[model samples]
Target: MNRLVPLAVVLGLTTASCSGGHGAGSFLPSGAPGAGSAAPASAGARTTRSTAVAAPPAGWATTATQAVSLKSATDLGALDATKPVTVRLGLQLHNVDQLKSAVQSRAVLSPGQIQSAYAPTASEVAQVTNYLQSQGLTSIAAEPNGLMVSATGSAAQIAKAFDTTLHAFTVNGVSAYANTAPAYVPTALNGIVVAVLGLNNVQAFATSPHRGGQAVNHASPADSAPAPQPESPCALSSVFIVGLPSPQPIPTPEAYTTGCPRNYTPSDYWRAYDVGSTSGAGRTPIAIMAEGNVSSSIADFRVNEQGDGLPEVPVVVKQVGVASPDTAGADEWTLDMTASTGMARRVSTIYLYATTSMTDSDIALMYNRWVTDDLAPIGNSSFGGCEAFPYLDGSMLVDDEIMLMGAAQGQTMFASTGDTGSFCSVGNPNGVPGGAPLVEYPAASPYVVAVGGTTLWSQYDGTYAGESAWNAGGGGLSQFEYSPFWQSGIQPVGTTATGQSFRGTPDIAMDGDLQTGMIVYIASAGGWTTIGGTSLSSPLAAGVWARMLQNHPGLGFAAPQLYHTFAMSNPGTKLLGPPPTINVGPFHDVVSGSNGAFAATPGYDYTTGLGSLDVAALNAVIGQ
Candidate 1:
């Protein structure tokens, strides 16, 4: 596809989906409460239990989400009647099915080949523009492929053009306006305009925030110990980092029985994962999707990169609307930047798309820009929408269309599965016992590769031990989406009590346990904070893809190939049940603990998905 953005960047559930769900599973937030440990309520709406049990009053889209009990952040935001609102017009492309077929075949595609095979025809773009004009919309700018058209209109004008209502809602101290009702397009643009965006801004998302910057205990707090700290400044080695708090009065070896040290850096991860030599090396420009500025953090990143003997990488920060630094924004950006660069050592550029807010509308626009930007081939999204949130509930179709567009252009988006384990629909800080499960979207989206987490057990000398499913990694079946054909071969296994044959999450996992977390510079946490969560996993995996692409240039989207290759090269190891001490070529079969509901079994399970990465082995399979 034609690279559009140049080197410059730009850049929930809960709402039951409109898609069909087999009765095999109930998409409720039951079972156990999530970790239930309080997170710094993500910047926009704080996710709360579903209060709107009653259906929409009248004349609402049948698929409209449960009415949320908003706390009105009137001080922070307001809906202005005359202010022109920019709504992205999603046009349905004509040969998308063909594109899917091609993707399934894993056929190598060149930029020109991908564009010619999947881009919307000029006629389709023109039709959408003309139809929007007829509805009195203004400031129409059609994106390159013509599948996206941005138009401006007043609230009244937008209401008249699309059947929807605008209203403001608030949660936690953040607020934004949204289309309270599900919106629709005119018959003139019915098939042409697949979906309209920027309608609702209710649902919000975040990087599954690192609460209090503490590591979660695997067995009990006594099983492992915190990392040793340096009391005297000179005691710290030249390469050794020193931001850790004084070690516990009697530092104990914490984390897995592997006795891995707590203090780690980008280089440590490089050596441990055996990806030290696999570098993006000034070729691939990775795209990190989040919000806020990280000028200082970028400087720190450069220092760390050079410290590791990797070339300095230029970071390009681009804004979607009007994004600013929020509470944990600095830390989020820092970790994402450094870790991704650490893996893809020679990556030329890192494009950070700072969206104005976590509002659903802005997020939709965020993905649209990422895909349509066309500069970055690989993307990393650390945040996720609550399944039942109205914003996400409404934009599912529009979002899917955007993902497919990216896929057609050889773009692959890696999203964080979530931090809340089996109880994805609900917040699980306490790591409670039972709660109905829900999967986070964008990750749950079939087109993207959902990255989960693992409790890495690599030691100081790079000695590898077995990894287990993170107590907090998100997984289970997608309530709305059906299983993708590529992964359909694996039998769906959810919590031990139940199983659903739907789209299961976390195509793969990587180190994310706070105990074994990657070391990152978190300004808000007073310098270096050991951070974990799928937030780390997503970018880590994105970097891996950048590496894979650097070597295997024409590799198709990762989801299909992961399964196809795994099935072909599965060592058929019978670690538990019987004899074969077989070796899984591409995967490191993780069979240990459970996420909450599901146990990490011999084969594919909800937690740890297809296990952690074996870079050398992975390259062998995917590079084919």
Candidate 2:
């Protein structure tokens, strides 16, 4: 049996996850009340109890003044609505204050209302729309979700006015309507989603009974915003591989346990190292985007094992498959099937599926799948929407709103480049034909670190070979303009800055081959079962990144560090540069393998760019 990867030795805690249960296992939050926790006074309106009962809503998607509630519409700023605007409502906010408390002074609405306990009444919509029309706002779609108001006004002025009202209104000693704050709003074009926070926080039945209570203080607090502090720095290290022993040829019962060899045991592994010092108490949230439910699975792991205890947080899961509790969204299973990997934290997977009823433009609702109050880096998407050209209509918008904005807001996004070896067209496997080589959507997104697949060989004695291209890894010139500055080192073949060679992909690699795949059990379809793919690799990387972020609370986004540590310096600089030599120590050069037609030539090749990261080196870079 192969030895357990160094994670156990260094971190001292072995956090293991199975196919079905909550990752931290028996340790699921019981929803018990805490001392400061408040109870919701009514079902629809924002209440202390309401905030604690469910996940908080996301921020408003508007300008300085015109932004709306989380339930209102999509943030069109990511796109130039001066061109065109699309609006849609998504996400269910369980607690408004809990979310607002995180941003204190910027509190706009209660969590309960954002979740729709208090959507606007038909009469209320007419009132708001009439007001907008009087103010010259046109192209309005006033639906049950919220109002979608657009006009040619200064975005800044409109946003400011909107926020003033959202943050000042209150009823019966609680925030009346609850919407997200302005900071969370994106840079939209002419489109704006008018979110009514005060009203959304309550149910009509509840609001009538509490009409005469003391007004709540709903304005942005002078000292409530987070204090100014240094931006945390971080670096991307080599993606270490812990090769799982393959299961029995016939797949026996013992194949998934410690009784089996190192590779076959546990079916999955979660790297567990303590973050923050014993005193400072740094909290690292593990956000997962998967299918079905893993609560039972996690509870089992905690009850059955002896460890630091299962991840401590609430798991708020929303089903997204067709025939959902809510109709506005798509079925989540189809999307979940493509995103079913496990994590070592309190895991909550939102189910979602693209449907015929969902217009091609209504894709923004997809971002609501994993937005929650427990802040943590999320394991990213596995499957992507179909696209024929370099760009997909709905792809970038979602990436901009969710992935880019999420990363900018301090969440790390890990995505799979593609299974097809490179973006150029290729022959189909199993006799099915392959589409023309096109850069995969989202993965090709500039904000995310596009991870590719790799194959590895475990020597008979145990140690594994350095990573090599998985023969199916994706890479190629990009179809879009290069967004990040660090992309300089990766010049696409056969073109200058002005040509097709401008865009590139597969920022890094991990073990993604089925032969040398990971040991994972999935509980969705039925009993425990093993599975692997670039899908597994993405989450594994995300979990590891969570640990790293926990370790370095000061870590900023990883993009800057990638270039500062690796791309900027070359061979000779190893001896020169500053004291903490960036690239030379942290990275492990992948000197072999290939992704089918693309050879993993020495140095930077299309297969694996600058190689994978080293944990220790990564820690050092993040520290810088």
Candidate 3:
């Protein structure tokens, strides 16, 4: 297992220890109540409870917001009261228990059906909207499902309205703002309002792509020209293999040496994973959760498709919030689109849900749009933060609700478990070892499929040789979320700080080592580059899932089905060995390598959860 670096060694902090859970200095105000704590009453059951507003003399009783945490933040000072702020009032879902049951039963419901049965009532939406309007907030809009109400107001107005004070802080070098005290809601809206988001402006999501080397500007003919190819597979084997110790020299495939720094092409992935001829034809659309303007990324994708001799998939960009010209994440978005389509070969439509930023609030809105649009049965989120961050800020709660809705509608979301090893990145993008072991959010959420990473070893012809868990692949038990019902019997025995069996990530993995990364076109970056991380793994999973949906359009909530399929195929939970000879079910169960605190075991280890995919095999039995 990889070891953690001391906090002082990693962050140069004088602090001797790091706290991973909510403590006395938590953002939630003292004695604040009304947060969901109890797990599902039974297998696949969801329970909803309202916070009782505290009775105060001659004033409206208030309850603390359930989703608010200030775990790793350092307070700077109070924000100027005149500063403007925007927040989303997350409304409670109606009939959540029924929704959970419907999803667990694998009943495929349409978006309309889900909304009709589980969306919050119109009155609930109005109650929150009216309250926000009365508080002098503007630009208020409630999502179609009435689960999230967004509004903008002055910091002073917000503080007065929510009974909390906004304060500035430096969270891991990012300038941010958060509520110094727990946000409160009137007693009247006890169950109507679940969370107050955007009170904190810390960016909770980061792109998971990891670059192998500096990209060349493909604008020049010399740069665009292909480099000399390796003479033979033996010659290619000289290149250092990632995640393996030196002197453990393994046979590297010629395909891996085709690009500078060794990047694999879409064709290579198709062959390696035995995708066969499945191209997601006649499949429901796929969605990519992205931020900012992605026009350049889309253009780059077209260039790649043309070069690969693949048909250009129809693309749609849905702006989820205030539009911004930021293309900072263009490469990440491009990777997601290209890698997914590259896997499927052909897709009906690719919807990009572009939000204004990666903030928790915007990301939540982006997810809400995808759930509501119902344009795609499979969606990919190539970005995530440490699970604790989202859990504290309430995005986990709000987004989980949105994902649950997607699950009920037969929509599946695939999220990267993160590029960090077993530990989450703290003030460092590459991840700091020696920090508390934590999983990435959204992936940690039981509602979505967590895609991990692996160092794939393929033959010269792209046939699968074997694979090991990528050293940097994100996996481990979640610190907060309880193990979902589907994971009851399969997840490794482990309890969270709350003493509940927490969820384990990731449910699946794909080629993600930077050494064997995907070759993608990034217009903003001026050309082709090799990138990996769970970011690529997730979209790859999504694309493969799209193919499965093409074969079995009625499939619902992939996690449960995947687990059930694995159990059926590998009866008695047999320990699987390395591939090529082992006929391990639908997945190529990885039995070697480790990712920090966890090692790749025969079955369901934290490092490479459920191993990587055997696309053709999975498609054959996914819905069975």
Candidate 4:
């Protein structure tokens, strides 16, 4: 799941390549796009039919035909003067085969090569390093594939290190190119090493069954199925949802961004939330945190239909981030913090003020406002800070405060599991003595239900068609102190030491793979891009919980009670026991996928935890 797709998946495009103009209208919101819903299928067909399967070339995923402009780097003085940042430049190797045969017979680093044991050697590493040395850049890390190089002298001096060119043609039969001789260099100390994943297999789709509610067969295929189990009834819990703005079309020249699916046609998301046939919706004042200008996205969703023939949840927008006039870095993330409509609704905007610029106090201030002023029972956070544990600590503090505030007013706080699995190297403070693996922060926090990821494949006929752990799913045992409370029904099946290990993530899951993912249209970015990640799942669940609370107005804050009611209780109890329905239960145990070393098994796997929700069952249990 930590693997990053190489540029190859981007249609052979690279930072250097560019495609001839395609009609902007060709792009539509994600999900089964018009007649061309199978565009990905066609593109994949082209790959298998055309390219030779003899191991893909190094930088195999590099897709673009042109170099990404370093002008932004130049204007921002990306490169530092004096003490140049030592960065492990992520690049696609132009000639991996030649380099591999020249070096290791296998070319790629043997499995035992890297620390986490996954990275392969990039052909560009050796060649680029050699070229850099010729220009006076020195090596720091002496890894096999690429060296961690330090730029000597000024930004301009470092910029001169990048001097080369590359070329390629587009999938649409157009030519494109990239300039190696970058005019500017990056100045930030953080140098991102971008790894291109599988080039030709990128996919995005929508999986809502017939609008007729025919109980669409939701079974995992043979190749990707969970161990066989008895059938259970539908867990019709309360459904909640938030709406986002409709996406504006991305113009040409920069139309590639349109590859992303935009918002669902008016009804997609809300309908999905209504799985449980419960009514009355509860007293939980579901809150949405947003930064700025999402009025259009929300309005579009409101007009959309829920499956049962209703508009998306009714929402009231309010400002909560930095003052509207302020545009500082903190102000940006503040917007996400303040924007509170989506988690319970499944749609909302990521406030710009939510970035690292805002202080914990600033975040706390925003939280207080949403609980007190905005009248939300639970605040859904779909974002997180850098891999630093301190950030998690601050978030935990805010969460605790929000919970307390919500308790006084009867609300709960929810946050998304961070998306930084590669940075697992970051240690956690509350972890075991032997230095446990540090899971994502805020999610790892005791107060939060650390969400995880999964890959969903539609069951065609009677068998599974395609399924794989979502390449981007995150999961793992907590390096931080195990919050035993979060570990209720989760028990080890394999090795007691392993299964019963630290508290893992993803209390629940929903559709999140970019392919089969929900659609989101962003007018700000002005394009349609398919979006996925637990960021999407957590909010969807939050919206459901909000609705459940709304329907059961007397069900005081459910955070602490959810664990007691459903977690580790007797099998007879709705939590561990058999769900009321004997046909299909609310939860679909994820017996597949893995986050890192952890695999999805019988009961709980890092990939999907307690499977997905039994909304109906959830409502029944909570309402009891």
Candidate 5:
């Protein structure tokens, strides 16, 4: 059973033409905001600008206007003119070239260093703030990094200020508001203010959480008996298998039978992934990008830790915007906390960056906090939206900038690739099975480690048995984002419509099949429940990453090193001649199964990416 819930927001921005190139060398196109020419002195050092540019007058002139489209939604009418709205103005970066170069070199800079060298200048911030104030908008504040400026006003005020119209609409029977026309900026803040977010309130991201059914005993076919009751912490010996006939649909759980698979616990993951004798040990701190009140989740974590006989990890909640009392995402947040901490066993701290809502604007703030705070070296985002929406609205570019800064600061975030196989879902809440081929954003962004799903089979003792790509796992070529430098030579199943190679997901895989779901404690649910999805896979990856960071504290971004390690282990020369007798690598390369359009292969494939990790082996060679 799939439970679709609001998790994050999606905001829109004006799209710009990008230059065609390979690797990090091709910078943002000239038309793109924040495109700079200066190069930093060193990866860790600050760059020196030749001269500052003067700000333009606060006159109302046409800047780039964001094209808006209400795909498949019914237009109701104009939104309430007096309705209050909050919008975020994305500012241009100071040294875009330098920031890209620093990230490419794997420079480990601090938050302060990143701000000093690459953040928007005071003049740029002032330009945007001045423009907003001139338009009669209030509560104008700029982020410390100067990447975004927030303002509040009524729908009329916002529409007038950005030269657009706000109209009400019903999307999948849900009320929503969007700009009827393109949203533009004043002439003064043309390139300086890249994107205007929050002009429309659209449900952008959907949480991927699939609940498991009662344990079935498939051992006896002739013996007709009642299904087994749900176990609090499922036994390790009750292994589940996929590909069997199910009473429900593809994503839903199959009918209960005898001796079927059960949910997995923290200890089960530790043993299955070969994470022996390694805890974060208070060295690595991680963050969870979440929404609403997670107080119950914290309580649930403590309950899980005590029940599992594990050490308690400190959790600090940081309210990004206003404190939201909404607990709609209780299962998702709780699963993130429990699954992540459960995998690492222990960590220095668990920071929850809870936002007011799951809107694109609010979620952007949550991500910005995680990057600018620089407290957590690793973070987990178990939510995402279709890549096309963000790309069209410009949040993709906005979030990508934040992630670039994160990469330069040696921070790694893991995001779920979604749960609807190779295509995006159009259904409300839990994604339906069909739509055009598109990957999930944040995950599609080259900066994050896009985690996919797998159906894991373990031994009776919970030791590693084998894995295959989960049928419903989200993985495919990106519609907008280009492939990063590390993925240069990799040949996935297909190419972009233009016959070019774009970014493909996921970067890695983990257990996400409902039949092999993790045993989680949801306070609101009143007890333990088995849940799966890319949501489960992402936090699990983050926890494993925390353990790796604990062992090697100096490791920077993980993708480059991960690809390099895989390439070293499997040489083309050897693969071309014959299949290697022995497989040698930090990852357990999954060579079976498919996620709709793509299938897993010998090396890197679209379905499973670089496959699942061998924690011990990965930790040993990640830093080297």
Candidate 6:
């Protein structure tokens, strides 16, 4: 009966002492050397891992003498040996270098060209599976791609196999188990193994939608505004249907617009981008992979689809693994699904994949299932975390490998850069003093197209005025990853600004400001909120790609072709085709605003990347 409880919990309104988070596991710098320098062996495991999880040496064991102590806020009491738990073991992919070479080579690929060349070889799978069997951990299930192996066993057995002590720990203010020391694997699976996961449930990955704007539950003085109430329940059809705090328990995708902010709807975005009418239906399916449930908003989705003028497309919901069926954050998931379907209305279908939890392994496994299952040709992952932590330590983000496979098999991935402006690490939940600013992961991976954010300040009359970089649009230099040859147009970040530069985000930007954000039905937020963030850009882009693929049959991995022409230019020169001075090409050229320290420059800057899109223009120039 207390309104405050639901609001506080639903809105992430908890202090360190209460909510579960990456607390107690914050990164502490012990002065590690840069790449190419003599760093600790563990610290020197060079790859894209260096830029993200291993930042400023994150929490990984940098020295032989320096054992990584995954400290706990509480003693966690003791671990029960009899209790069974699931642990994830990671494996390295085959032909990693070759895959990178293909992506950076700036070659337009044919469908199934790259995937045919790169895959987890049988040797690698045998090497991992053989080792796991040797550990007496027989309950093993290899992922569809064979990049990972999941097994279940008692706490004691799992701990011993991982060469660590299992300790009861808490994260996000919830009780869980974790490893107290750096987990050790056998020599057979050492280098071939990127990292292990599921050892600690405490630091399991948690993701937030990139949407910007304050979310309020119940009633605040701000909710009383009557300027933008919907005329009917289905009036705001393209809106997201979210769930509110507990006790309202109906789990209905209801819409109420009496007390919501005014913002652009999916229809508005369609009009803004001039998403030309295309009867080219049955092109590609847009699969949205996220945590939590999707069944809650199916009814509302049809309403939005009809209202948006999108042809009736089959909408399907499937589970990656055995995730919880409980209705939690249902509305957030609905937002992504509806937004994507609304944007690329001609798609063949929409597949929603959910994992048991947002843990690192769960997220990765779900993605593995989606890709391996060949669920769709286009993928949208709008989840990421602050790049300052060792998200790659126990469980390495094998996302790049998976993404490469996707690209090879005619799939293009679009991920949100982040929503924390330039300083994506500013408010790390770990509560540690993060050394410097950075962008979020998956976006940092060169294989995935990092979609950034922007604010469209124009008339709501569906006419364009001008645009600027969104203040909260995430962008910055990757501390570890170097820019590929395709991305050589941007200046590298090392001392020389030479060929040795860090990869920049994002490759593109779109409408992502609360004022000019997406207006979706949020069954949770009472009705609608002007939502904007790199999250919105990613799915929207995926939708656009779907539309393009309809006309162009084999537009596999568009980034390479994109960079070879429009986005890439000489180091100090303006892009050749799309003049930076005008708005005539694929991009709108967001030449204003800043995301923390980085400003949107004349051409491409970290803030808005190459800028918003002219969908028709982009698809035309992509391959030819």
How well is each residue in 1-624 modelled by candidate 6, as lDDT tens digits? 000011111212111111111111111112311111221122111222221223322222221111122332554645688778787665555455555566565444543554355555667778877777776776788875676778888888877776667777453476766555545565544445555666655433344433433332212212222221233222222222222222111121232211212245565566567665643466778888766666766655664555445567787777766768655546556666767776776678888777787665676677777778776878787766654333323332455556666665667778888777887643333322344455676677666788888766432234344567888888888754455556756443432233355678898887766555665555555454445666677777877777788877766676776666564432333432111223636667777679888987766688887777766666666666
TM-score of 5: 0.82
lDDT of each: 0.59, 0.35, 0.69, 0.35, 0.69, 0.56
Q: RMSD, each candidate, Å?
A: 9.8, 21.6, 6.9, 20.9, 7.8, 9.8
Q: What TM-scores do the predictions have?
A: 0.78, 0.49, 0.83, 0.46, 0.82, 0.77
- Best-to-worst order by TM-score is 3, 5, 1, 6, 2, 4
Model 5: per-residue Cα lDDT over 413-502, one tens digit each: 999888888865543322112323667878988889999998876544556666778898989877556676677566554454444467
353-446: candidate 4 lDDT, tens digit per residue = 2211123323444554554443555566554432222221122323332333333344555655544442343332321233334455445544
Model 3 C-alpha lDDT per residue in residues 389-496, reported as the tens digit of each score: 555445666788888888888889998887778877655422212444667777888889999999876654446767778898989987556666667677766754
lDDT, candidate 3, equals 0.69
The better-scoring model by lDDT among 2 and 4 is: 4
Candidate 4 global Cα RMSD: 20.9
In model 3, what lDDT does residue 85 have?
A: 94
Candidate 5: give its CA RMSD in angstroms. Answer: 7.8
Candidate 2 per-residue lDDT, tens place, 463-505, comes to 2224556676666545333434456545446244333234456
Candidate 1 deviant stretches above 4 angstroms: 1-80, 110-117, 170-174, 211-245, 249-261, 276-280, 306-309, 322-328, 390-393, 425-436, 494-500, 572-583
Residue 252's lDDT within candidate 5 is 21
Q: For each predicted model, how many residue pairs clash, with residues at least 3 apart or on different chains?
A: 43, 79, 4, 120, 17, 21
